[model samples]
Target: MRNLKTVYLFELSSLLKKKAYIVTTVIICVLILVVTTLPTLQSIMGGENTGEEGAFQEGTFGIYNESDEITLTHLGEKLPGVTLLPYESEEALKEAVLEEEVSSGYILKSSTDYVSVVNNVAMYSGGDYLMDSALRLVNEDLALQEGGHDVEAIRSIMSGITITQEEPIVLGKDVQNNYWVVYILIMLTFMMIMFYGNNVATYVAREKSDRTMEILITSSDSNSLIIGKVLASGTAGIIQALFMGVTLFAGYRLNYRNYDEEILDFLNMNVDPMLLLVYFIFAFTGYFLFLFVYASIGALMTKVEDVPSATTLVTMFVMAAYFIAMFSLGLSNESIILKIASYFPFTSFMVMFVRYAITSVSLFTVAISYGILILTAVFTAFASVKIYRFGTLNYGNTGSVVKLIKTALKDDNGR
Candidate 1:
């Protein structure tokens, strides 16, 4: 035990002494700080006031008139942000949407129930929302005019269905401010972990390919060496995350100073500091598990050229897990796939943290998921250590995956 401790400390000290590590850390910290501050700076420079009227820019819409009563002249005057271009046929409007002459335009069919809006672009661009809202307004106005309903009567009916959406008082403020910061923080944490976790694996691979691992392993056991390196990399990643978080917080304060009370109330309710700490712990543990396995694969490679191919399997797994977590946000925790992913070592860290942050997750579930993660991490660490014990001493061309596994298992049995 003492020998293991000695080895761990020695490896950590050696890493600390390396100038490259310090330089890389500084570079990453600077990058994170810059990236975090840019958005706030842009917001300040741009100011709160927008020159554009409404959410979207004014665009020409091609209105295909099938009925003689509905003319573009009256419709164009009624709509505020749209310029109506009269098209004789639906084909012409469809061609316009396809040809990029128009962002999006609608075809008013003979049937009153349906108005088809051509949306080639993704929904995020705000074009889809604008088109849908405009079409609905036009339909309502046409209906009232056709029915010969009095303007006052139409207004009364429209005003009768009052939608009172009482914004939930969160942290003494409204829901909008409450939810945004928490969501951003959660996403940032996940990204940082993934970024640095890959770095740790790559670092190990580079050392192995350069024949530095053998020299380092001579003075340190694999377990001690891997733990020290993983810890150092994890610490660096956490520092980057914290720097960005602080920068963002500062930016929010400076930029939104006038709205301080509302912001504070929103943050106070949604941003749980304890949740961040738990997420970090889980992120580090799950990341280390994958890093260890990745390093083990790296050990089987003979050159830096081999590192990419060797690590591709792990990369795919990580990417899939990342996408799944992102897609599963706001979904029920009891969802079969999500529940299974929450307990799966590869995905548990990101998915479970997201699930916990967005919804009310039980402490028992958190504990159980983390417990499984810890056990898996320990097992991976031990297995990788045994593999490194043999693989570092190997010479010549890289061994086959089967041979590497066989040798690693054999080394474990011999130990």
Candidate 2:
């Protein structure tokens, strides 16, 4: 334990002082700040993208809606970018438009089951966007009528359901861009695994290539040294992630303070603090878990140049799991591959992280995945320790998998 602490502290301090690691950390922090604060900067610069730039002049249209108990006046109140001029009679509505009292006229031809939008010009660009929304609202109203729901019940339901999901069963309306946020988080998690995990292999390969492993192994067992280095490298990654996360949160807060409704209509930085905590924990564990594979690969290679090719399998697994998580995260009936990933330790980090984040996955299921992941990590680290001698003392390619397996077969007799 004392030896491990010495090695761990050495590795941590070495990585923190390395030019590559420091540069990468600085770059990531800059990226987080830019992504989080861009909307606020745009608003300040009068370049915010609210999609309301070319919107029609407000309060300019005449409305004649006589489909149900819902009056034209009520519907007009809902339309944000345009004004609806209500009339006692359709004649008055049409006459006002023709006489230039209003910009144009709308006569909703509705039925017990259908809603259509008609216009005077026969050419309405923005009208489609608005009418599509109104049509969805009308359809939802018709759906609730079958259940014989009262006004209060209907209003309660209306408060949540929008045009997109007739029923968002897994996530609520309050979760704006839930899929997007979680997907980005998954990618970020994989990025950390790739960047820092690759560094583990690189560190091992560097030590071997420089013949530093010889002196180090003389002082300490290879397993303890490798484990110590991995622990330290993972600690550095956690520190980097925490810094990036704090920068994102701080930028979000600053943006919110200067939030302009017209500019920030598309900006909602309201990430659930609970979700952020989950993301950080998953990223920390997942990156550390991936480091074992990388360290093993590093121990296999004789040269630092061989690190990337040696760790190709790790990259492939992470990419596959991320894409699968993208496809299956919020689906009502998740894909079979995702279920498989949830059980497999290699893929569970991403698949299970997304499941718990966006879906209705229970805490118990994620806990089980965590158990499998930790066990796999331990097993991999032990196996890496066993094979550490195979390539570290050797001087060339070592043919990785085949040679490592052959060497493992002979460790008892050969030594």
Candidate 3:
């Protein structure tokens, strides 16, 4: 027991002292700091206030129309920011537009023709939202005139169409907020699995390739050694994750003091704190399930170089689950694959949380999903331990997963 504790401490301390660990931590901290300072930096750079200074925009449009029915006053109401100046002659309007005295011109070339709008820019560009709205209104007015409806009748008909909502719709905000949570959850899943899961695999493989397992077995039981190291790696990862979380929280508060929204509070629109906690716990379980499986696979490998090839399938499987969760979102919450994925342990880490976040499910359904994941994780962990014990004893290259498992089960050394 004492030797296992010593081994656990040595493994964790050795990893913590590595250059990769230290540098990665520092880079993450720096990124958090940069994110914290972005708003302040933007404010310092003197950004544009589009709404307040809207009137400062140039370009007065000249109009050539001999209509007594339409006036600049009617057009001004439809087009908020445009300045329309009337010219009696088409030639005068054209010359004004060319001289840049007026930026553009709208001419009724003939009574039979539609209004022509032109700008002097070298390449034709879609101007702005206001311009598009103005053009649509002008076309509608012209069409109504052709239909023998006056401006007053058109206004009456348009104003008669009203929107009535019994309950205010917030479905968009709910989905958007859910997406924000899902994105953060996916990042957490990737980090945990890539760092701690791969760490367990590589650690086991390194010992095997180094022939250090012979010495390790002499001091402690295989179960104790594997469990202790798994615990140590998990503890180390949890500590680093907590530290990063705290640092980010502090940076967020210090950086965005003036900002009203916080990540936690921002997502409070649809999900409750308890539900989020459940999501986090279930995700951790799924990670643990895979981490131990990775360790067992590592035990089978005779060389460190074999880890990537052996574990590539598992990595791809996890990645596929991530993509499913990513695409599912609010748009496909009711999908058959997503529904199946939510109950399965390998994918529940992301799919379940995402589905729960964007859609509503009963408490009974959550309980069943949680039960299945817990059972799978517990079973896979124990089964992996037996395989780990046998795998460490077998030497040379492991050809296939089936052959390795067959040999492990046949070996009398396995638990």
Candidate 1 local accuracy as lDDT? 0.66
lDDT of 3 by residue, 1-415 (tens): 4467777788789878989888888888888878876766756775423343243344577878776555667667776566778888988887887777776677644333335455445453433444556656866777877888887776888899998879557553366656776778777887788778888999899998998988888888787778777877887787778878888778877766434344336724565675687678888888778888789889999888888888887887688778888888747347889899999888887788777777777777888988999999888878787888987778885478657877776678885
Which TM-score value belongs to model 3? 0.75
Pairing residues by index, what is the TM-score of model 2?
0.67
Model 1, TM vs. native: 0.67
- Local lDDT at 205 for model 3: 93
Error at 83, model 3, angstroms: 10
Which digits, one per residue and each the tens of the lDDT, describe model 2 over residues 49-125?
44544554344666677767565544554566676666667888767866879766666666323232233545655
Report the Cα RMSD per candidate. 6.2, 9.7, 6.4
Clashing residue pairs for model 3:
none
In candidate 3, stretches whose alpha carbon ends up further than 4 angstroms from where it belongs are 1-4, 48-130, 140-176, 257-270
Alpha-carbon local distance difference test for all models: 0.66, 0.72, 0.75
Deviation of model 2 at 3, angstroms: 1.0
Residue 47: error of model 2 in Å?
3.5
Ten-residue stretch with the least lDDT total in model 3: 48-57
Better of 1 and 2 by TM-score: 1
